[model samples]
Target: MNDTYSNGKDVIRITDVKLTTVQTRRRTGAISSHIVLQLSTDAGITGVGEISDLDCYRMYMPDPAAVKMGIEKVALGQNAFEIAALHERLLAYMPSYFRYANTYPPFTPASQIAAGVEMAFYDIVGKAFGTPVYNLLGGRQRDRFEITYPVFQAKKESDTERYLGYMDALVAEGVTRFRYYVGVNFEQDENFLIAFRDRFGDKVQLKALDFQGHHHWKDVLRIYDRFRQYGFELLESPSWREDYEGMAELRKRVDVDISEHISSLAQAMRMIRAGAVDVFNITIQSGGIYQAKKLFDLAEAAGLKSLISTTQEMSIGTAANAHLGAVVPQLHYAGDPVGPLLYVDDVVTEKLRYDGTQLIVPQGPGLGFEIDEDKLAALQAGLVEWDRPAHGANYVSD
Candidate 1:
């Protein structure tokens, strides 16, 4: 509707834009790389944006290179306020090589470009309104969010002691809720849950487990039976994606509530229509703010809870998630907005902070945070060469 930032002009020229990668180390032994976008106008006002790469399925997709070339090719001399137009143009012009193995798959490399452009557009809108994205979404519902700590693969039984020690320190630091992985290592899962129960003894009210689609339906049911004794709040991805029939059946079997990792709003609607999940894990990078709001509205109508989860994304997506989680009407569960806390360092001007169990939405203009231009330039200068990988680590192709 109102393009106030455009000064009543039909078009705002996109003067310059750049993309850089920031690598953050995670305790899970995986390094996360964020592709940051900087968009500037002729009037000197600028916006920041980011997108998450599809690591599990489409890890070979070189999203940063596509994002860089896509912005350079389509964003120049265009109106930043014309978000829809820019998004569509980028979608049309994006190289077909970036698409996944199957053309019909919902998640693809093009989706990343579309998400990045949408976020950049949101940044433009936020800067124009002089309000944070959260305020624009629907005002703040909660000042903070409960953090969900991720526990990946554990080596030995003794490793559970180290993990408990780590959680103990975090609990002292004001984190009350925690989520542990329940895949591949059932012993670790049992040990961690037992340790949590023994040490905390129900002091931690919120405890959950995530299977990440690494277990069978029967195994999930068995795990749920065991987890019920410990009073788990929820279980995420207990079954595989596209197993709605199986999920609905498990919903009947499991004593604990189930959450789905339906990344896009389309899948969310499908899950709701199928009555498969009790909680919806809304990821902003997978679906833009508009679509995310639509998904939240649908979830509300379907009487399902909402939890803002992370995709190991950067500050741009994290800021957007915080705003969405703060403003949404049906955010019943605490969000997994712990990317900043999990990372060793971030490449943003203002870092997202945890207040007790919650993360406050930034009150600054635009996405409520600013970009570090110096750090961005330095990161761009550090890029030696970029190429798209194929298949596995051994396969290399442009």
Candidate 2:
């Protein structure tokens, strides 16, 4: 028999990993991948964890089998509570040649392992102690979380009407916050901005305007001036990821709050250190929970807010984000942790359901979720090809 404590039980063995892909109607051009981690112990207790593939970005789709193989080799017979140690070892053993890429391929594989294992450990701990993951982190600050739906590729002249209609539908469904793909070329989309401001008025409490790093200083400054009139809350990725100086300058020039979305926590810190942003968009999987917590701490110390957003991951990743957001003190804005909502189908026992605008965090164990193995197997069997070329791959790549 396994030893049990008031803080739950220790993880004895990692049982299995299941990965699945699902399509979504919300965002037209991408597929959602969900990774589920199952953990078992000598005490006959079991836990489940969900993580998403971080390399969903074009030009870097990793083989799920490869990820599974790599993780299985390192994860079996490991203690789930020692998540940090596992993450370190995975990083150390990952091929150095694959380290220089923008998307960490090996890291993605290991992310599943680390997240799954950690979640299972948390489950063991939570189940034994009868506490939620949020309680373990620091207790829940808020029971409900706000969601921001993204309006992608709204560039056409008629797109304003289409988008407004879409927003209206979502608003009717209880979604108040919105993140529009304003892109960098603001002048071209002036009508859309004007329409958005006019339509929602004060009913909309928050707006995360995504500029996709295409705006220049002069244009962004102009757009900020206009957006201020509508009382938008945040401007995400207003400038290029590399332009720290520009970001700092924009922060100085604009009165509105600014946030940045880089690939990792290290980049987030660098931007924060440079005094370039007011909020940090921390994707949980990009830099696992432990490192993400560190980033949140950094943001808090620097008097900056944290926005826990999604990396277009499946429900597992979304759950992890919710738990992390629920615990962290620095999380100020409700994030786009709605990958499940966006998808047509999700592979999980319990889907992360939203009540109107507020997203309720799962209160079970660990990350508080389970995988539907039968559904996952069905999805995996549907995989036609692993290397489908993503759109605009050449353009996004340097």
| Best-performing candidate as measured by lDDT | 1
Give the Å error, residue 207, model 1.
3.2
lDDT of 1: 0.66
TM-scores of all predicted structures:
0.84, 0.82
Compute the lDDT of residue 24 as modeled in candidate 1: 55
For model 1, the stretches where C-alpha displacement exceeds 4 angstroms are 1-11, 27-30, 53-59, 90-108, 374-398
In terms of lDDT, the poorest run of 10 residues in model 2 is: 389-398
Q: State the weakest 10-residue window (summed lDDT) of model 1.
A: 97-106
RMSD (Å) per prediction: 4.9, 4.4
**Residue-wise lDDT of candidate 1 within 1-398, one digit each (tens)?**
44554656545577888777765555443455557787887756677877653443343646566567767787888877676576567647753312221111233555555666677777777777677777666788776666676655444687678777777877787777777766656776677677778988877764578776656677788877776777778888777647767888898887777887655655666677777899877666544666567667778888888778766555667787777777887677777777776665667776777776777777777787787777555544221124433211122322
Model 2 Cα shift for residue 394 (angstroms): 10
lDDT of 2 by residue, 181-263 (tens): 66524554567767777888878765667776666656778777776665677887777536777889988977778887544
On the 0 to 100 scale, the lDDT of residue 74 in model 1 is: 77
C-alpha local distance difference test of each model: 0.66, 0.64
